[model samples]
Target: MSSNKNKYCLFVVVIGFLTTNSAYAQNYKKLDSILKTANNEIYSNPDNVIKIGEKVVKQAENNVDYKIKGYKLISDGYSAKRNYEKSLEYLIKSSQLLNLSKDKLLKINIINKTGIQYHQLKVYDKAIQYLDQAEELIAEYPYKDSVHTELGKNYLVRGFIYKEKLSCAIAITYLDRGIVELMKVKDVANSSSKISIAVYNKGNCYLLMKNNKLALENFKKAATIAREINAKSLEAFALKGSAKVLFLEGNYKEALEALNKALSLSVGVNDLILNQEIYRGLAENYLALSQWSQFEIYQLKFLETQKLIKDTERTSVSESLGVKEAELKAKKIELSNKFYYLLLILILILILIVLFFYVLVKRKTNEIKIIKDKIYLLQNQKVKEL
Candidate 1:
């Protein structure tokens, strides 16, 4: 009866263990699906991305990978909203987890993303530092597809950095390199947006260089690719770029037409930068055509958008300071916990060592006592024999 009861208990324990493992597997799978959805909607529905990412982060528990991914997704959402400071905060959280993870690819991705955030913040040197780290890791990473993809992104950001620095000639080189790297991937659909971005940026560089012919060609190509992918914001930016070239070439009517189309497409995109550029472009074209009233309206709209951008930037900076303070507090608490844990482990080891010595000493004493007893007995027996 006892044996049967023991077997039953063992069976129950095994079943419980398997059930726990299965539950964990299911939870992780669900989180993966949620993350995929968040990524898919990151551009069009940034708020949804943040919401889904927060859910994943809350549910990740002790899963390092999922937690990091959730943080990254949140960062991406903030980036899409043009809240670079908030985006950097989440990315820093992801970076803090790197020590707990053995996944090099994850490290590479997080570092790259951090660099991109810095670039958006106009911290060019810091951005390059992080990108350099990612590039070094990519060199050692064995997966060809992932390496190519990440490298392509790295080059793209580099191009943007140079472009922002007003080095259009150097920027074009990096953008061209990025395009080539991105095209090396087998899944063209997955990389279409990135490729289009590279091409668009290249067009911008040519426009800055006053090479209208090449600029128009690249913008047209980028717009076609953006249309195919249904990337409305990209298409709008491309159209806006086309309008700029047309305006510079003394084609006011055509520029106005392109700007109107870009404006139509940008309605729901929430891309403030693109909207500002479009408005400014429209105003320029109207002024060129001697339409004072139309030009005044768009010029006012452009200034309003510009003011809105400044306000958003100020808010981001304020929130970033708050996030920094919170992170500092968190770090202090984590350090305190680690210190206590270390002290506890040291105390346990000391106690274990003391107990081990006590056991050894007690056994030695017992053996000595037994030997002494035998000696006394032998002496008594010999005396009796005498």
Candidate 2:
């Protein structure tokens, strides 16, 4: 019983910290500010994040909009801190706060964020659906740079999914399209961060398709771009991708140096995805050198990272399945509507035919009556003459 009480208390703490106290922005705008601060501190200091998150939550419990935003903020903070499960929880909560919004854009943002969470979970189908919805929403939006970035991400993610499935040709096509579209976007449409991600994906496509020289070139270009924008995390990612190419080509010595730098830069950022890549590179390099111990260590790390990735993917795919189901439902509705419209048109034509025949019959009846009256008058005139 005491254990149960403790569990309940913990749940309350989690819930309370993730909601706003008022429904309107007026009463709970402070929560947003507080959440923003908490999110900022989460990567730099998890303890401070929890502190500010708690403060924000305590202040905004009943505010639906604030609660929704708060949940998303907390999710981001947890994700930055590498607490994947916690992040997923808050993002899911944020997703359920639909009643708080009438703005299509905010809803879209939430969907996009949840889609990202699904991607992290490795649930590709769900990620695709959310991303697709986000794209549809973007098409209807007045204008925004973030939407373009989201679409670019959707394409890039799709490319990654295809690459993972070993459909290198399809992956490259999508990545190339994504790159072109992202470049053409203007006026807050360009996100250097988003651009770098797409370029990295493009390089992956090249590598997977066995265009090693092009892959090497794109990776180098992306790394330079990352450095220019102060994105150490992505710079490491580009290095890691390049090193993997070298490792596959039996260039263990060079791959080893590249992997070392990649790992060094990535670990500080808690970039699990990159960490996984570096480990795989190390495993291949160690195998090349015939170092059993180093090879085993790297293999273990890679396997662990792979399992985490697979889990993330599964979550994304589950969400995507729901989206697929929703899409199927919508299509069915459209077909039903079309059928009804066709039926109504046929009925309308039948009504017109019936009305036309009725009018013709009435006119003929009146003409017959006039003819009979004339005949009766002529007969009376003949009788008078007789």
Candidate 3:
């Protein structure tokens, strides 16, 4: 009867264990699905993305992978909203977990994203450092579709950096490589958006090179892809690029029309950067057409927008400094913990060494005593015999 009861209890425990594991698996799947949804809404509805990310962060609890992912999603959402400080804060949070994560791919992604954030902040050197780290990791990473996509993004950001530096020739090479890498990954999430961005950036580079024809062609292609992908902000930027090309070609009316279309799209997407660019384009077109009143109106709007951007940038810079301080504090604490851990290990080794030596000496001493006793016994026998 006792044996039967023991078997029954064992069966119940096994069933409970299986049930718990099954539920844990389901929970992770649900969280993954939620994160995917957040990713999809990152561009169009960034506020919604932030909310979903917060939910994921709370639900993930002590799961390192999921928490990092949640922080990344929040960072992306803030980036989309042009809140670089908040974005950097979340990215720093994700980076802090790198030591705790064994996922190489996750590490590469977080490093790459941190680089991109620096790029947005115009911290070119820091951006390059992070991108270089990501490149090293990618080189070590096994070949996979996702790796190709990440490599493409890395190249694309590098291209953007060069473009900002006015090295159009070098930028074009990197942008082309990025496009090729992205094309290698079929059906990858956000690949289309990334491709559009690469193409658009390429157009900007061409414009900088004074190659209006090539710039127009690239801009049109980028706009087509962006529209197909429903990436409204990218489409707006592409249109703005086209308008700039038209303006350079002395087609003021056509430029104005393109700028108007871009403004519509930008307003719909609520992209402040695009709005500022469009307003400036409108002002330029009106000035070229000798429409003084219209030019004045748009110029005022452009100035206001520029001021707003500057104000936001200033605030973001202040907040970013705070985040940096916090990160330094975290690093100091981690280093202190590591130092103490090393000290503990050294102390343990010293104790072990002392114990080992003591045992060896004691064993040798016992052997010597035994020899002395044996020698004394032999001498006593000799004396008795004598």
Candidate 4:
């Protein structure tokens, strides 16, 4: 009877332990779900990101790795709004969290993100500082999934910055370097878009230098690759670039045809910046052909499109901020529900522990009673025999 009671007590303990652990697993699974959902909406819905990131940051109050990811997602949302100051603020927070990690890859990624943020703020020197740090780290590690794509992005941004400063020769070198690295990874999904951008920019540099032959060659190759990858924006830009080269070569008819196709594609994609560029190109083409009415129409359209794009950007930023606030309010209620569930689980675990001890103590007490009775019976039997 005692042995059977002990076995039952052990079984009860095991069951209670499993139930408590299951509660822990459920809580952790909630954290994982928040992370996954935030990642999915990071690009598509910044407002949703703010809510999800808030939860992750809350849940990761003790986990440095998760804290880093949550902060980074918030930073990306701000970056998408072009609120560079806010973006940099969150990125700095992420960097502080990342300092706890000894992982080389995490460190490299943080450096790269910092550099990209500085680049967006037009702080070229600071951008170079962080990018160079990442490059040095990569050199030390020198692994395959290394910084290949990131380094390509670094060079491309540097090339553009130099071009903005009118240091065309230096810009060409950097652009060419980026082109080489980017082309090597052109088949990679993430790398393909940047590859096209690098090639197009390189072609633009050659055009600026009056190397029409090489410019046209690069533009054609960029267009072909962009088309293959279904990168509509890059393809449109490439077409526009090729049109410019054709215009320079006195092929007005061919140039206009390419411009028309580029304009159509840009419009279909609602690429306002490209659409404005296309409008300007059409105006120039019409002016060259001595078509005054067409030039006037397109020149006005170009100005109007630029204004519309600016207005749209401002409106979108405002809307995202408002939506984020609402989401946070809703998230509070959701978190409250989760907290209650957690409280219930805790209560259940406490009750189980109490019951387990009660059963164990009761079994021990009964065993003691049985032992006492056996002693009494043995004493009586000995006295009667004597």
Candidate with maximal TM-score:
3
Sliding window of 10 residues with minimal summed lDDT for model 4: 37-46
Ranking by TM-score: 3, 1, 2, 4
The residue-level lDDT of candidate 4 at 150 comes to 66
For model 1, the local distance difference test gives 0.88
RMSD of each: 10.8, 11.5, 7.3, 20.2
- Give TM per candidate: 0.77, 0.61, 0.80, 0.60
How many residue pairs in model 1 have overlapping backbones?
A: 0
lDDT of 2 by residue, 112-204 (tens): 777776676666777778878887888888876546655666677777777776587888777776776677666321355556766777888
- lDDT by residue (tens digit), candidate 3, 234-331: 88899999999999989999999888888877754656677899999999999999999999999999999999899988987777567568778999
Instruction: Kindly list the per-residue Cα lDDT of model 4 for residues 106-158, writing each as its tens digit.
Output: 78878888888767666677678888898888778757555677678778888
Q: Which ten residues in a row have the lowest lDDT in candidate 3?
A: 264-273
Backbone clashes, candidate 4? 0
lDDT values for all models: 0.88, 0.73, 0.89, 0.78
| Model 2 regions lying over 4 Å from their true place | 1-66, 77-84, 144-146, 162-166, 180-190, 271-273, 290-386
Which scores higher on lDDT, 2 or 4?
A: 4
Q: By TM-score, is 1 or 3 better?
A: 3
Regions more than 4 Å wrong, model 3: 318-386
TM-score-wise, the better of 3 and 4 is 3
> Ranking under lDDT, best-scoring first?
3, 1, 4, 2
lDDT of 3: 0.89
